[model samples]
Target: MMNACPEKVIRMMDDYLDGEISPSEEKELKDYLQSCSDCRKIYQELTKTIAFVQSVSHVQAPPDFVQKTMAGLPKESQRVGVKRFMRHHPLMIAAALFVLLMSAAMMSSFSDDQQFSFTKQENLVVEGQTVVVPEGQTVIGDLTIRNGDLRVDGELEGDVTIVNGQYMASSGVINGEIEEIDQVFEWLWYTIKGTFQDAMSFFGGDDQSIEE
Candidate 1:
C-alpha cells in the first residue's frame, strides 16, 4: 500500500526484475525499491525463479553417453564406405569447359604459321603497287594489273591484263591473251627495255667492255 500509485516506477521495477531495464531505469528502480514493499516482493520472487531455472538448466554429459551411441551401429557391415562424389553441377562444369577452351586457344596461338590458300582464283594488282607471286603459284582466273608493276614468274592458266603499268614476266607462261593500256605503258616499257638492251649491247660490242 504505497501512498503514490507509482505506475511508472512499478513498470521500471518489472523491467528491472526481468533484466530488461537500462542503467538509468535501474537507478529509478533502486529509489523506488527503498520506499516500496509490494514492488520489492515481486522483484525478489522473479529473481528467485530466474536463479532456480539457471541453476537447473545446465547439465554435465554422462560418461557412457558417447559409448552408448557408438554401440548402436552394426560391426560387420561390408559396404558402408564413401567414395569421392564429383558433382559436375552445371555452373562448375561450364567454368571448367571455358578454362579448357581458353588454354587450348592460348597454346595454339604459339604454334606454327597459318597459311591461307585460295585455289582457282584471280590475281589483281593495283596501280603503283608491287605484286609478288610466290613460287609454284597458279591462277585459273584472269589477271588484272591496273597501273602497277607486276613480277609474274608464276604460272597463270588464264589471260593477263594490264592498264598503264609495267609487266615484267620472266619465264612464266600465260595460256590466254595478254592485254594492256599499251599507249601509256609502252613508253615506260621501251625506256626501261631500251636502257637495258643498250647496256647489254654495249658490253657485247666494242663500245663498252668490262674492266677488272
Candidate 2:
C-alpha cells in the first residue's frame, strides 16, 4: 500500500505507535490504512498488544523496604572514612586498576606501528622459508604464502605455506595449509617492515625512539 512493503510497515510499527514516525510517512500510512482492511487490523492488534504489555508493568515493591534498608546504613557522621574504605577494599581497588591498564593497552594497540595480525593462507606449502609468530593472537583460517617465511607464536586455524625460508612455531597452532618462496631476504624484509609498522601503530608515531 502506498508503494510501501508490508514488511517495512510492520517493522515501523514500533516507531509509529510511539508517535515517532515522520509526518509524511504518518500521513501516507494513515491514508493507506483507510483503504486497506488487513493493514488496519494489524495496526489495531499491535496497538492492543502495546497497551496490554504496558499495563502489566504496573507493580509495587514491599512497603517500607526502602526505609528499613536506609535505616541499617550508617549515618553520614558515622560512615567509614576514605582511608578506611581504601584499607578495607585493597583487592577491589587493585582489580579496578588492572582493568584500567588493560583497557589502555588495548586502545594503544590500535595505533601500534609494528602491529601484526595472522593472515589466512589458502595453498599448501611446497618450498619456502620459515619464521615464527609470537604469542597471544589467533588465525581463523588456512594460510599460504609464496616466497615468505613464518614464525608462529600465536594460534592458527588453517594450514601454513612458505615458498623459500623457514617456518617455525614455538607455540600457537595452525589448522590449514602453508606455502611460501625460498628467499632469506623475503623473511628479513617482512620482519623489518612488520616490526616498524607494529611499533609505530602501538606507540602512536614514528617520530619517537624506543627510549622516548
User: Which has the greatest lDDT?
Assistant: 2
lDDT of 2 at 53: 90
Off by over 4 Å in 2: 1-5, 71-212
lDDT of 2 by residue, 90-126 (tens): 5675566555655555455434323333344433222
Q: What is the clash count of model 1?
A: 1
lDDT of 2 at 16: 88
lDDT of 1 by residue, 102-194 (tens): 455435432411321122255533223655454577767776655465666677777766655556866766678876644634534544554
The window of 10 residues in a row where model 1 has the poorest summed lDDT is 79-88
> Per-prediction TM-score, please?
0.29, 0.30
Candidates in order have lDDT scores of 0.58, 0.59
List candidate 1 segments past 4 Å from native: 1-10, 72-212
